[model samples]
Target: MHRVKSDLLSAHIGSKPSKTWRAICDGIDVLKQGLIKRIGDGATTLIWACNWIPRTGIFRPIASKVPEPPVLVSELIDHTSMTWKAELVRNCFFDFDSDVILQIPLSMRKQEDFWAWHHETNGLFTVCSAYRMLVETKKNREDYFGSCGNCSDVQRIQKEWKHLWRMKMPSKIKVFCWRLAHNSLPTGSVLKNKNLANTANCKICGAEEDTWIHSLLQCNISKCVWALMDEDLLDLLASLRFSDPKYWVSYICCNIPQADGIRILVTCWAIWYARRKAIHEGIFKSPFSIMIMINRLIEEFEFVQGIDFKEKDLYQEKSRTHNWIAPQNGLSKINTDAAIDRTGTKGVVAAVCRNDQGGFIAASAMVIPHITDPETLEAMACLEALAFAEDCGIRSFVVALDCLNVVKNIREMP
Candidate 1:
């Protein structure tokens, strides 16, 4: 690791360096661009140089410049308590950076500062995160996307992308939708444009061009899937057509409820999968069968998620969980649970607090944008539950976590 930092990250390039060495050196900036400072003791990290602020754009503070004002991150820390000095933070930085800094949870144990891959929640780097980081970095290039057309006009389309990303579904389905929005799906017209195919017409509908919208949302086969899943949305968006798939998605997303949107996204993915199967595996199924499969898939996902959302009083799913036991008198009990995607890349954390008599007190839920493990999520839920309990002025409370590992770790902690 030291060699890597020295040789690849900080070393000066020589006039006679090998091609492989030069390549590694050249890629250092890209690697460094994704690395963020995970403030532990904060003694080693420069506040101006390190990517510490957890925002979408630049991680460095707008108030501070690199290597000029030489400020250590430790200056922002309250050494007595291992927490951020809130007043100092607010005084030193602008509102946006201060808010971001204060929201970053700190460990009770003050450890050494370290570099973590910003893209992953676990602070560990992965090839997948690296690839995504590269793609996002490239988006800044003017010619990378060829033409953005009108960003203002497509903001709604981008919001649909955000909503699609947040939906509780398989990551592959979300990625498929993303590619579909970018009009990069290998439909007949796209393939033809790329010179990979001779014809641009839809194989099923005989349309002039098989665009992403037509292939995934409009063809007779897709229409049948939607009619089975949601005939109203089918009719509402039946005439929806755009030269760009993004506009069609934006219109549909704006018109439908998010629940129906998930169904449509999943159905599109299934339709694409079925098309591949028909072509490659020589298998064919009726639209009803495809819809049935999609329905089952959605039901299973919702059934799992229903444990957190559907209950009127929360935790009423007797089949999945044990019966709820109220806390002792004058005390409150908090229950926390989190749901993660299939890849564990993100999670939704929820905590519900109730009085000793089982009446609700306060409840909160938040999205963990990215996560490496469910244990961390469960632990975070516990923390949020505790914080919520404190905010509600509950002096005596107990947090009930389903994660045995986190519970055991808490018990073993000194």
Candidate 2:
């Protein structure tokens, strides 16, 4: 049986009279040798015997299809050389009629030919069919993979996929690049690369070199602003013995006590605002001006929250020393004033106790705002004075107010 199988197999392989058939026979011989190595001599012989083929089927297909056989068939022959190539084309031609390859019409025979050639050359037909099966499994997620607008629009999802593949981005930067590409960041509008012509020099300093990082921090003008801010902040930080920016920010935020976090935020925001003004508006102001602007911004932020920095600092100092008190005679002179400005609107209430020489012994100011009515403002002022007195360890003190309505309100209180 083994001898008969080998004779029949050789005859069938040789009778085909084609290079493809010869190559297939060579592959089978290699496979048989591999099987012999694994399964031993008798098992290999049995395998060959079970796998033999007749010569009839092999020659009939080509002989019936072609009028005459070639002298020597080439292994590098094109697809047209195959007897079944026309039948394969016909099957794919009708397959396209079923509305497959939906984007490309069936009338595009050239495109169909290119696709078939690609499949055959790259051996991707099976892989693509498997991918189609996986895609069909995700039919529920079809909406996400749909076109941007109406199906009639010329926009193709395939083009976007091809572009994305060509980008070859690292996984870490991919999402960030996607957001940037989609114009989704807060700075996205300002961060445009219009053209090579539009981006010649730094707009602020007229420097020939201009880049994102340069415009942000490294440019001469930006560096000057940062240097001045760093100097002041570094001085304050040195006094606190914190050298690093992170440590300085943390120290100021934690130790400064009142509205320190808000102050830090305002300071940073002011610095960026100044840089933007310089770049966009071409306003090259002094570093001192920027610092002043930061101070004003901080004041504005505090004012909106009904507070003042200077008065707050003084009050905190007095609160720490236990010196915000009335006179020993149970009489306190309260001076109330309101500081109203575009940046801030706050009412100040100060309690003072003078010595025999008319020098101030104890004084305190309460800074609070959002006062709509004059009477309520004065009452709040007196209350602030009394609270200061109580905080300074003074239990009994006479409260004085310039407003008669405030005086009347305090007297009428049970």
For TM-score, the strongest prediction is 1
The local distance difference test score of model 2 is 0.41
Q: Write the per-residue lDDT of candidate 1 for residues 286-391, one digit (tens) a residue.
A: 8989988887888887787652222232212345767789988888899999887667556778999888998988899977643535677788788778778777
Whole-model lDDT values for every prediction: 0.73, 0.41
Global Cα lDDT for candidate 1: 0.73
Model 2 ranges with Cα > 4 A deviation: 1-197, 206-213, 230-272, 275-282, 306-414
User: How far is 56's C-alpha from truth in model 1 (Å)?
Assistant: 3.6
Per-model clash counts, in order, read 0, 0
Please give the range of 10 consecutive residues that has the lowest summed lDDT in model 2.
101-110
User: lDDT tens string, model 2, 266-359?
Assistant: 5444545666676569776676887787677666656665655545432243433434444455344444533333443334445664533345
Look at candidate 2 and give me any clashing residue pairs.
Answer: none
> TM-score for each prediction?
0.48, 0.24
